[model samples]
Target: MDCILHTERLTKEFKGFVAVDKVDLRVRRGDIHALIGPNGAGKTTCFNLLTKFLTPTSGRIVFNGHEITHDTPARIAERGVIRSFQISAVFPHMTVLENVRVALQKKLATSFHFWKPERSLDGLNARAIELLREVDLAPYAHLTTVELSYGRKRALEIATTLAMEPELMLLDEPTQGMGSEDVDRIRQLIKRVSAGRTILMVEHNMSVVSSIADTITVLARGATLAEGPYAEVSKNPSVIEAYMGSASVELVGAH
Candidate 1:
């Protein structure tokens, strides 16, 4: 398999307590890989390690054939690994078009001016509009992000992430806090955007994971307990055991 992101013995510790314990994770190019686990599973820590937000205590992270363990967050992003935060990280006061345009502006690396008009940026609006359309937010381009529904705001955030032109998009719960319909829309949007790019997301919505993930990794106690296609991992006794007494046992779409 051609892996765009691979980690070897990735470990993180805080005050002598292991958070991610020697995790070997591989995400193939063009795959919608999912990381799933119950609360306290250190999934967030593992994500931080991969994104270079938190340095690993030990081990290495390779992306697109380059070792990036020592890379800064901006450098990691420059390497085409972009992460969306758990919350919708849109500018509430800015229009949807302006929000996406801001991301494009960042990509151009111009001196960021907080008070500048969107039109003054020159050559950003057209690209931003295209991105908004890509995420189905074009129709709402003029609306301030604060006026958008939660789902629409999430969509806008994705449009902003897309503005970076990432080769690998690391989405932290792309569908979190969404209603059923919104979840379905985001799932379809993810499918659309993932056509030529890779996606590695931490998602708890099993239905979404089952519907979209090519591979799923189940983590417990800071280590991977099961890793495979959803069909195989869902039936693993240890996976079920780890989720025992948890809502995931019912919610997971392994069956």
Candidate 2:
């Protein structure tokens, strides 16, 4: 299988507590892979380790066949592994278009040239608008980000992430606090954006995961409990027990 990202026994510990146990995760290229588990299952910790926010206790992370376990977060991003929401990329005061324009600045290698005339950035507007359109935010391009609805803000975030030209996008809880309508929208948005890229998201919404994820890896107590398509993983006894029965029902229902 053409894996774009994978880990070999990746582990992390804090003050004698093993947060993320040895995890062997493999994400296929052009697939929407999900990392899911109950609260405190070390999902975020695994993401931190993957993005180099927290150093791993041991094991190696390989992306596109290169070892990135020890690389800095910036270096990982430079390598085209971009994690969204770990660092908020949005500027609330900026217009939606301007926000994406700022993210596009990195590609021009002029991100720090604040003194450049406003017209210097005019060249970025067209591409920025295209990205906004991709996430259905083009209509709000002239609005300040702070004025957008919560779901729209998240959509804007996706646009900014796209501006980075990521090969592998890591999304943390893309639908965490949304109503069902918003959830479905973002779920579809995620599906739409996954066309030519690989997405590895740590998601809690089983419905969203079932609908869009090509493969699911269920984590519990810092270790993988199950890994497969939702149809298969949802039936795993251990995964059901980890959710204490209720979520298993939800998983099956979602499937």
Candidate 1 per-residue lDDT over residues 218-237, each given as its tens digit: 88889989899988887777
TM-score to true structure, per model? 0.94, 0.96
Q: Which ten residues in a row have the lowest lDDT in candidate 2?
A: 246-255
Off by over 4 Å in 2: 86-89, 245-250, 253-255
How well is each residue in 61-145 modelled by candidate 2, as lDDT tens digits? 9999999998999999999998777344589998999999988998668988878798989999999999999999999999999
User: Which pairs clash (backbone N, Cα, C closer than 3 Å) in model 2?
Assistant: none
lDDT of 1 at 221: 86
